[model samples]
Target: MTQAPGGGTAGRWAKRDASVVWHGFTQMSSYLDDAPVVVERAEGHELIDVDGNRYLDAISSLWVNTVGHRVPELDEALRRQLDLVAHSTMLGNTNRVVVEFAEALASVVPVDRPHVLFASDGAAAVEQALRIAFQLWANRGVEGRTSYLAFGGAYHGDTVGALSVGAGGFGTEVFDPLRFPVLRAPGFDDPSCLDVAAAMVAEHAHELAAVVVEPLVQGAAGMQMAGPEGFCELAEVCRRHEVLLICDEVATGFGRTGTLFASEQCGLRPDLLCLGKGITGGYLPLSAAVAAGHVFDAFLGPDPSPRTLHHGHSYGGNALAAAVALRHLQLLEERRVLANVGVRSAQLARLLSAGVAPLPGVGDIRVKGLMVGIDLDPPGPAMRWGRRVCAAAVRRGVLLRPLGDVVVLMPPLTVTAGEIERIVAVLGQAIAEVTAS
Candidate 1:
């Protein structure tokens, strides 16, 4: 065991972390005992802990990482930006890099004349989209368009507005008092969720400002997915009703779903889109709320008047973030990442079907591009199979995380065939060990 600075054994780092830093969605009293990985640094697709242990980051660092960590091109992009500037207010003024990046993004996002409002994270992006949808109706003098329609099993973000639209799981029930109500539709797990949502939209179009959905995959909802055709039908309903459609692609965007945006696969051109997670290749805090030309035009009357949105974030369009984001976009094309996602997604599905599906402890498997969830079956309502299975995988040098009983696998886009095999082998071993014991 290595000796760390403050304590004797480096494992004390978790204890030190528990004493100070409060982690989200973690029980602080059991933080140190839970044996959280004290990550010192990362290389390629592996995270190196303080004790010099390297674990394959099978979850893509909670699905934020896209290409890989410590990427040379991204590092160079950040360094080049640092030579000029770091951050400036995007409030009344704009930065050069912001314009350049936004132009690149606008050219690609699946929206008519997309205009981006940058934010620091996904929650803010979703919140911005919600606010824009609400204000669009108010600005256009449309009455009774105050409520929103969001599907069940949808997890947008943690902010109040985002939570209001979200289906509310993952220990978020305590904050229900703060979450405003929205028209609820069936979750993606339901075969006819999209059709049901469309019906609800048509029935409640009078009071609906927008219908918010997570296009192909409801990521936080245990990677639940629906067919692309359902999304197309729901979008058509939103179009016919003249209710703005908002796609919260904070998890499914930036090639996570076999395309630049999941909306592209679903043939959707939403009025507003929320983007995050992989925007800067997991390098920085960057997200955006994209508005179509029509929605953008709604707020175009009188600059210093009620039409103008009275909201701004201090570090909305930080130059460093924009610089890295621009490079990331270019690299996505240059490296042919999306094509690789297709090939690997097929491989992943095949491998899971052959190796993991028939196990006595396995229940179900879902895959959409590189995003995956393997549900575990425990006899007699056993608890924490997910947590134990993930911990066993970590001990075997592959990092995995779970949502309830669904173990997620989200490797970086650049992951190789051998790495995928290694991940699958380790997960199978982990599951075997846990179920046997």
Candidate 2:
């Protein structure tokens, strides 16, 4: 393989990165050989590496970026917050920006009379939700409702509490000793998953604190998706059983799945909603665990009361993050971003079915709006077909990543039609080349 023009510069950066930067889910020893792209800046939906090579951000920077990189509105929001204050503890006192953002968030989230508890990332949000749900039962003087019900192939987060309820995969099994067990249900791969989950909820309702799910999509499980009706059925089951329903929308929120929240499409009123990723339009790290009014009321008590659910992050409601997130939320509506998502989603479905799905080695293609996964049938274990295909796409100026044998393509919400075409064309060519090899 040939290197780009600034190979020397990229090589130096890669060496420096390998020496000090221990990236999560990466093997540093082979990082240099992998031809890692060291990004220096971003423009619109493209990432410019140190080598001056521009690659289309096919996965929205791992499904976080929404309105695109370097958005002017998001940048100005952060600047405005900086002029007032940057950091303040949410433990005792709350900042004005935080309060305003929370109000704005509450207006849009699917939960009724939602109360926001800020966190720094998706895992923290899930952890907070888990704790809140567990304590909600205890606060209500409900005994024996101590367990949680989660579906298989669920990827909530990596924190101990989050991982406890999450279905273990992706090299997480080694940490089984640290994770607590939950009542596991089948994933969406099985057509009867919802039926099975409903039955589990009925049988375990007496002991289940909450029925946690990813709503309409299980992103980390190779973009596996469930029908809106299926989610509605599960919600109905939870309601019938008198069990709380927690929607882990960390991946599906902020118009990733053609809706502000997947629960909205499913007609679900989750007791708790976990949001992250695009909350700040990828400008900052911020997440929130939104609780319904009833859930919030359960924790209400006098000062220093044991009924208080005590958990918070040092940078929980950072002013800058809140300000940016509030502006991002506004921009989503003002710019009619969800409308674009609908159009782009249709285009993507057409392109994938016509261009990529029939390519050699392509086994299955799963798509829900912009989130996509292409399952590849490798010739053998040594082929590493998914990684090789993504590498080939990168060489063609398209950035992509794979989940084992599943290649994902999740472009920014603001991506243009031409960019989508380029992504699909490159992916198709890459798959063809790798399979023919």
Candidate 3:
């Protein structure tokens, strides 16, 4: 075990971390016993621990870092904005960077007259969209349309409103009492999925506020993918039923799925789009809930009447975050990130299907642009092959975090072909080592 450079011991950080921080989704009882690695610094595609070991960041720091870590442009953008303003409430007033970000986003997103409502992170974006959906209905004289429709195996987020629609996951067990009722349809790719969704809309159209989905790929749900065929079909269903379609593109946005936005691939425009993660290239925490003109129009009324969407975070449109996001968008356009994602996505799919998927214990391999998922059959003991693979990959100097039983990889969009090859090579070796042992 590597120790910290400070005097007392190498694992001091772990002990200190364990003593104070209660990590999310972690079993803290055995935290220090296993000696957690404390990250000291990061560079492009690499993270260095306190012990001075370097590891390739195969998961892009939980699928956020697109332009890569410590980029000069993003750092400078943040610094420049910080020199002016850092945080502000997104009520009554707006900042210049925030306005620029909204304009840049509107130019790329599919909706005409797209208006952005800022938030701080992915889950917050989900919450904002949910509230907007319900508020739109209420403002339109449809006071009964408060229930939402979500797919089984969907994972929108962890917040109360987000969790309400996130079915087929154990995460909501503790919060079930507090969560609102949300109708669940059969997940995409199920034999009767579309039929099930149609039936739900038919049965609940009068009461449906919205249908939220992780468009194209359901990231937290084992990276389960549904092609554009069903997505376009679902869009039509939502339109016909007058149910607002909310595309949770927090994971698939910013060219992660070979397109600037996954909704574009389906030839469908969502009523509300939730974007985060790579929006600021992982430089700062930022998210946006974009709505069409019709949706936005629903909230326009006299000031004292209070028909507005009643939600705003303290740091909703932080100027630094907005500036960073603007710079990141510029970088994406300048580099033609979608083109790179397309090329690398195809190469990764071919390489993994031909090489890694055939290995022992490897059951299935799925790829979408820069995002990839490796499902291990039977999952074996430890019960979560994906989590084990992540730990194993770390030992082999590759940083990865898996979703349930899926050993997933979502590297930065800026990664080179050579880096892609090395990432896959190390991932394959890690899979073999973990499965073999």
TM-score-wise, the better of 1 and 3 is 1
All-Cα superposition RMSD per candidate: 2.1, 1.4, 2.2
Q: Which portions of model 1 miss their true places by more than 4 Å?
A: 1-9
Best model number under lDDT? 1
Clashing pairs in 1: none
* Winner by lDDT between candidate 3 and candidate 1: 1
Reference-based lDDT, residue 127, model 1: 93
Please provide, for model 3 over 1-437, each residue's C-alpha lDDT reduced to its tens digit, 9 standing for 90 to 100: 22322323437777877778998877789766544557889878788887787777788888998978899888999899888988776799988889998998999998868999998889999999999998887788877898999988888788988988888465558778888888988775474665678678877889999988887787887777887777777778789989999999999999899888999998879999999999999878999899999999899999876687879888888899999999999999888887888888888888788778888888778788988888887544666677667777777677787776788899889878887887778778878877787
Mind giving the per-residue lDDT tens digits that candidate 1 earns over 169-208?
8888999999999999999889989888999999999999
Model 2 per-residue lDDT tens digits across residues 57-159: 9988999999889888888988888999998999989999999999999998999989999999999999999999999988889999989999989999999
Each model's lDDT: 0.91, 0.90, 0.83
Distance from true location, Cα of 19 in model 3, Å: 1.0
Least well predicted 10-residue stretch by lDDT in candidate 2:
1-10
Clashing pairs in 2: none
lDDT score of residue 116 within candidate 2: 94
